[model samples]
Target: MKTVGLALAVTLLATVHVVAGDTRFERSLRNLDPSARLEQICDYTAMLRIRASTPFRPDRAVGSASSPAKAASNMLVANGAAFRSRKKWYRLSYTCKTTPDRMKVLAFDYKTGPEIPEEKWNTYGLWR
Candidate 1:
């Protein structure tokens, strides 16, 4: 239920840091492999993009909540993903597509479900 952003970012930042641009983020992506890179960008996208208005700011995103994310070519789909806003964890699912180089996000879609039960948190490897 947290992030490093790309997987690189998701893997990079254990928690999100407010930034003005992608300069530092871009540099960070260079450190991750392709699969991780895909996760990172998409995870970052989840926190940054959304049409449905929510109250709190999501500070973190996890590519895998109850299961590992699936990747194929330049696309990554994570059905068991989750994100943390303030102190609550919400169910999440996301689909991420990247450019040929797998460095830029070409398209992304995600939906956040209900708040996860605290009792199920440990089972899902979620933390406080």
Candidate 2:
């Protein structure tokens, strides 16, 4: 019974994680350049993880803000990223690591910064 319970728990955990990629996210990668694909995967992770972990609902995320992110070899360290939530842009930075094919996000670590001032949005290429 203990073995069965453990197996069941593992199965449920797997199901929840796998369900995140059951959509067209993986399929869409076939059409993008390698670098673009990596960005897409990491951006998707940003939106999904933030929504799941925070009260904010992020619809978009840009990896570049005040400065361009450092992306290389399946890893992206975005120190000046931004995420749009509830029509407001917030400062965001994240380190996202992905698989070789850039189809799966292996890990994502992120921090949300203070709200970007409305007057300064133009400087960062942020929208209203």
Candidate 3:
């Protein structure tokens, strides 16, 4: 019984690790085209502040019957970033996909503004 319990615990931990791994996410971000609009505001050369939220259900697929089906365990969410401007700070959101193999950004919209009080921008050390 003890051996069975130990095996189950190890299996559970391995499952959790596989589900949470996100190695490809940053890799995708690094592969973004330099001329892309996203590059204009956020300086990838400098350190960035990223805040990832809880995993959420991704939107259901539309008309593409030929595409591979996504697993129910795969989760997606929008992650926040704090970046430095000339002398100011700004925020943007990057859409990310979390799968057993890796996590990567699917697509991201344009950067936003100076950020608000509730955003806790200072926590990211953007003010410096």
- Which tens-of-lDDT digit does each residue in 2-116 have in candidate 3? 9999999999999888556433435565465532313321222112223222122212111111222222333222234444434444444433333333333233333343433
Single out the weakest 10-residue window by summed lDDT for candidate 3.
56-65
Give the candidate order by descending lDDT.
2, 1, 3
Candidate 3 C-alpha error for residue 115, in Å = 5.2
Root-mean-square deviation of every model: 10.5, 5.2, 15.9
Candidate 1, residues 26-117, lDDT tens digits: the string is 88888998878888888888888742366658888888988899999999999999888888888899999999677888888888899999
21-97: candidate 2 lDDT, tens digit per residue: 55656778878998988888887789888999999999989888768888899999999999999989999999999
**Shift in Å, residue 62, candidate 2:** 0.6
Error of 1 at 124 (Å): 1.7
Ranking by TM-score: 2, 1, 3
In model 1, how large is the Cα lDDT of residue 22? 79
How does model 3 score by TM-score?
A: 0.28
